[model samples]
Target: MPDSGEVQAVKASNPGDSQVRVYAVAPRENADPDEIVDGFLEAMTSDDPGFATARKYLTRKAVRAWKPEESISVLTNAPDRDQADRPADESKGRTYPLSGRQIATVDASHAYQPNAPGEYNQSIHVVQQPSADGKSKEWRIDSLPKGLVLGEADFLRNYRSVNKYYFASGENWVVADPVYIRQRQDPVTRMDPVAQTVKALLEGPTGWLDPAVDSRFPSGTQLAPGVTTLVTDDQSTLKVPLNAKADRVSAVACKGMAAQLLFTLGDLTSVRVEQVEIQGSKGDRLCLLGKAQARDEYAPVRNAGHSENPYFVDEHGKLMTLSVGGRQPDRPTEVPGPFGKGVVPLKAVAVDREESHAAGVVQEGRELRVGSITADEELPPAVVTSSGVRPADRLSAPSWDGRGDLWVADRNPVKPRLWMVPGGQGERIEVSTPWLRDGARVESLRVSADGVRIALLVTKDHHTTLQIGRVERTFTDDGQTVAVTDLENAAPRLSSVTSVSWAGPSRLVVVGTEAGGVQQVRYVQTDGSTSATSVLPGLNGVDAVAAPYGEQAPVVADSGNDGIVRLVPGANWQPVVKSGGSPVYPG
Candidate 1:
């Protein structure tokens, strides 16, 4: 048997893979109150289905009241347990105080939200109770936290984040909704990771994303009875059996369901799910979808073929591009357009996803100009202009969505607003942002590739912070109206945020500083949670940062001292250009 506080590892039988499965030992006989507490905490981090082993250390009454599915508290490390100061009485029980630095929490909805490092204090009371046989007495916890408490390392080891795909509301393109699931078998449902992912997809998107996305699965749809383990066949195809609720879905809706499953299961690195075959209640085949078919029919915006090279404004205020992929020349070449020829000095530039059009902020940040990047063309007339005298109080850097729409923010204190230009040239529409009506100014903004979400850097009361808002569009007699609603702080831990950019479907790379700390660059999830490896290597004087949608692509940034630099995986930041600023990747 493994030693106390140690977990035993064995191969998983259901998946038939080399993945290790973790198990925790039950409470030992004659264990003291401290030992029982320690055993229970260790069990919380193991793969014991339904946490049965962990409950062995709790009293019968505690077992009946505890709800491990309520929430999960994650800390920086294992909590320290110390005996409380109160005198211990055998009849009154003993209290062990647990303390740690709390980092994040996963609620009952399986949505993970991060918090600034804060003190965590709780108590576990243990008392002598009759053993299960009622013949002897044993130390058992009578009162404790309602949910699991785990260290960051243990949490990462046991839980994995998976993106469950959902279609953008009223749109064909799918959006990624990230949620945490067990790395092995889930303790509650006794379902493996693949099954858990499929179940989550059926359950629908999280609260934050529900309003912006839609699930094609019919209401009350679920996995077939007695089906828990999901495995791919020799052909790399997964067959999913669903309950009667999904028996009547149309062929089109069935394909959407299969696409959702394909995308969700593709994120599980342990298994290869290339094709998905959906079965009805009576085992009748509903639809079959292959990876290629799904991509062609329901391709995500991120895979819409954005440029790989990073773009920036050179020392002469001309737009330039540099090749960062595979043995390419490090030399920076001016783009083939008026913006590249310095027709008008630029302060910032945003390239469309297809790299066919570019938007540049010129005339001292007061005018927004859109021009072609693939051919020589005169810089078009200013599409939008700001009356603010100071550059800092004027237009922000422009960002384009996959649908060929342009997003920019005007920070004129008297009339701050966010504008969207249809097809990068039509009349600009002011996107309603009620949250900004309270004297907050949008300093910068980036639209998600799906065009369903937008990230804004807002300033108020001398403090700048990062917030994400849902971009909701509604068509009526007035044509189409847009509003950015349900804004949430994406980086509350950062005392101030200077730059924010989307790195993936549900992740952002931000440059910010914590209270009483120096500036740093880190990755934060759209749900506000962060992982232990989120922080990048140190770099100084970073003015702006941009990351490509794919993880394998290098992150580019503009630094005051280092100029333009790129950070490749497994390496520190390397200077890309010694004279460029406002570096950015195609949106």
Candidate 2:
């Protein structure tokens, strides 16, 4: 019997801001068919370690055949028995068919994507099985599905996406690699939240993201032998012991490893990891100097140099920053640059992180120009021009990287390529991305605040899909070069993606159609897991969307209603500006 616990969304205070839900554990019982079925379903949706209890409902043969990780179906309701079945026989096996509508499916690799909301039927064959004491026969599932299924709310309660840190390829900084995990584990369980995170970091990234990210932990590295739990000491310090393999690394490398641990552990919402103490196999603390480090040098740069207010291009093609937080210039003020002068009929725009530069596409969408946000002089020259390509095949909305470089992709099917304007000016360098294939043309691109990733909305065969790729960079004596590689589908299940904005370091707000074929605004993790949070409410006719940083207010261009709408999480979308399209935030 499962505890009578109701599922509810608990807002996360971490940077990811994705909702975390709590699930109650089900008590063990294996008597009748209904009890066995109820307990099995409840256990499948729990974060129980080893799933030892769930196996109790199954016969020895069925337990061995079931592979819960093979797939997970998200449903809107609990699976109910097929009413058409005949009465159960006490001496012979009986099949209990269950059915529900699947909202999504999590594949073996744990990629959560939308699924067509239609009937999904499964079954379990049950019969009397000898008890552990051989004293009595109990109803046990003789056959079961290979994977698991749970209502949408239960899925949210048991699973969450967490970012484990890895050193960038250059080892100059750390990068977040998001992965799904249990939000809360049983206290008496072997998989401690902190320990599980450390183990995952050591295990490294998935096959698809391995090329784009690197780990400081050495190859074949493992946590110290017999290490199954991690708890802070009386002084509130987390002590993590690693195998002897890490002892040979230099102090700098040790520090980098510690930094990765610090950031990754800090992202755990329920844990308060004030400091991380890394230990060697011999039980001595390594990296003493780095152990008490308070600041995270690898965290994404936020508001430091970014505009405190949001901005949009008005109907007249002028750039204007909205007055937020009761700041000066009460009314919407035009930016102090060529965009403010309205000389170019701009169709789309983006500003650099420092709010010092701007990039936009001309009304014809055939040219991409960059200019100083505060410059009173003429607009910067067009850095990219498509002379023969159709206007619609010209360029996408520009995105500014943390390095102050501008990125845009030409939609020309004949020669489509992403271009990087280093420092937002000068030479137009073609960024080769072999994964942007199948005749897909870039529709929009937004760089993450960390600058190592880009979210892309691409159209192919008349359908649009959202994808994420790594921006690999190399610096030389002459300058820097960048390329977007390892492009992974972020919303492969989405049929149409109109807009995508970075809501947090490892999270994106995606507007698209679900596999069920309904359009809505929802949160998506970089690793392709859909957020359990409900879709943004009342978002209609959103042509574009812009977000400043981590879970901050996001504004949308409601082209259908001729107004700009602002999204307040858990609330309705409020109309902000009366007219605008292609709204954008400072890079």
Local distance difference test, candidate 2: 0.73
Q: TM-score per candidate, in order?
A: 0.92, 0.82
The candidate that wins on TM-score is: 1
Give the alpha carbon lDDT tens digit for every residue of 146-232 in model 2: 787877666666667678877667645566787656566632236776777788788887665677678877887789987877887
Off by over 4 Å in 1: 1-22, 85-89, 302-307, 328-330
Q: Rate the local accuracy (lDDT) of all candidates.
A: 0.88, 0.73
At residue 18, give the lDDT of candidate 1.
25
RMSD of each predicted structure? 5.5, 6.1
Q: Using lDDT as the measure, which candidate wins? A: 1
The C-alpha local distance difference test score for the whole of candidate 1 amounts to 0.88
